[model samples]
Target: MMNGWIISAAAEIFWREENKMAEARSLEEIKLDYAWKFGCGRYIQQREALETLPEEIKRLGDKPLIIAGPRAWEATEGRIEKALREAGIEYVLSVYPDQNTYEKAREHASQAVSSGCDVIVGVGGGRIMDQAKASAYFAGEMTKARSGHFPVVQVPTSIATCAAFAPLSVMYTQEGASLGSLRHNFEVNAIVVDLDVIVKEPARYVASGILDGMAKMVEMQNGHDNITIEEFDVGLVTAFTLAKYTMETYRKRGVQAVEDVRAGKLTKEVEDITYLNIAVAGVISGCSKGFGQTALGHECYELIRTHFTQEAKDFIHGEIVAVGQSMQLSFNGQEDQIPALREMMNSFDMPLTLKDIGIEPTEENVETLYQDLYHSPFVKDCPEEAEKLRKAMKWLCE
Candidate 1:
């Protein structure tokens, strides 16, 4: 009890001090810095990988806090629970309340701080992993332990996105609006990718993940000359390099892997493609350090959340973004790249346009889209850009 009290008081003091520092610091007085950091990214992609959990991971902490997706926890509990018990690791499990938002992350972080957990675990798909990272990061801030950064271990039950390995969280509001991406200062402690677990998830998740990973390369094309980090941007060049290879890998192996997933076959193609989407794409994001043009495909998805609010909720992030990718490319006069992308999206059953997202191509819908597009961040304040956006919306509605 005394220890807990002391820790709590210390956390309060640190929080107060942080606010004071923030208030005192000026924009010009601040000196920004970033480091190339890496974490223990492990891939245990096998039939019973969890059954043979790594020895290094067993001792991550004496007491751990786990934030899990309901389905994911149910699917992998027996295997992981037994392993944790065997290793004498005690864990507190909290089912994620079906949303990955900043509020939820802070709530879990408070739980971690109050529980005095030394390590954090996230089980399930993309949102689960992202929330885990966010919680761990916040836990560190709420507690002085671990130097304001708690280690996070991810157990991904689905290959839906790179959330498992990326040192970032794509946050959303309780109302389901895109809060955009939140990149963390630290990397993930590890990722336990059990093939046996991933094969059980819906095949669409794999396809969606591939389509999303494909955007890592294409979306980078936007905003190079727009709002971006200033200074030695060697990381940007390296990020693009890896993103190019990530796209190439996707082009070569994406279809076969999706088919393999659909068949529930644990083939080499599935493993490679899964890792590419998670690990490789994660590295690309890490290299970018959350800088450069972020407002393109994802921005379009946020716009959809507003325009097609109800229907947009039915589709996953990547599928909507796939539609946005086409719009993004088209808006930028990069229509030459649209055909092959659309073909691939169609093959994966991803939405090709706004109509594919279940909206009627009516006069009302077109006008609504035109108004939004004309004033969109990427299009507003420029007559030529507004015309481009109008044309793109017409094409998408068709």
Candidate 2:
């Protein structure tokens, strides 16, 4: 009986060791199963960057469809056509006349298909880029019927937004009202930014870009607590570093840069700020992923859109977001930062209060804006802060 009991004990120890080995193997398998998705364009930003487009185009295909807004086409059509002709690359130029709407995107996509273009090149500011990117995506969807997708290249004429580097595009109605966004599974194949062209753009566009970059940096910093450990990887690290650099650069030379650009003299500071706007800002935004924040200000833009006057309809995106940032700071109990932010905005002629953007600070308007904020996804991060935001809006009116 004693021998039998000892044998049973030995068998139990052997089974325990086997289970441990199996558990270790399972962990190894789990590690192997881990995957991550990251996307960004092959970015090229420099003076005369457009000169390299021919080589880039050859990599994709000889036949390219160039899409641009009216103004952008007017500014760079001669140079673009010259480059294509010099390279002996066959191409078709299409001007997207309407807003960045789904309908317009589909229209352009049909044009691309009928033109037998193998590549789509988007050139312009945020809206134009979004339209082109969406057009490429829709074109791909159409081609999926034939089992393929068209590659897209982006050439930004203005650094007003990161639409050039972003893997998604914001959609709007025909009248330029927000209708959320469309995300693509892939990034643009390449992005080319010609400093010469960008410098020639109005300083106001660059200023608006600065303000937008500032708002994004501030929001991400303010909401760092919301970032999970898994989300705080190299991407977040790079984003934070770039954001901090952008803020510092703007603080030191933002005013001078704007002045120089307005004077048609692209000083070193102007170039630096331009690069910050077009490249660094886009990188920071792209790398931020789940850790990024787009609350208060972004939501406010959508809420107050219908309230904009016809003249105010031309208001730049960053200007509105800058004001939204101030409102957010007020709600977040970071009021001390508002004065400096306001000073910066004032220096660049950015809007501050609701009245500045053509929105009357009436109780009805305030309530509508607040209700929109209340329903936003950001509220989940600060459920109790809605009252604070509401009170802040009242102070803004005052």
Best by TM-score: 2
Clashing pairs in 1: none
Candidate 2 per-residue lDDT over residues 339-369, each given as its tens digit: 8888988888878887887778777877766
Positional deviation of residue 314's Cα in model 1 after best superposition, in angstroms: 1.7
Clashes of each: 0, 0
Estimate candidate 2's alpha-carbon lDDT, on a 0 to 1 scale: 0.70
Candidate 1 local lDDT, 72-105, one digit each (tens): 8888858888987887777788987576777788
lDDT of 1 at 388: 69
Error of 1 at 273 (Å): 0.5
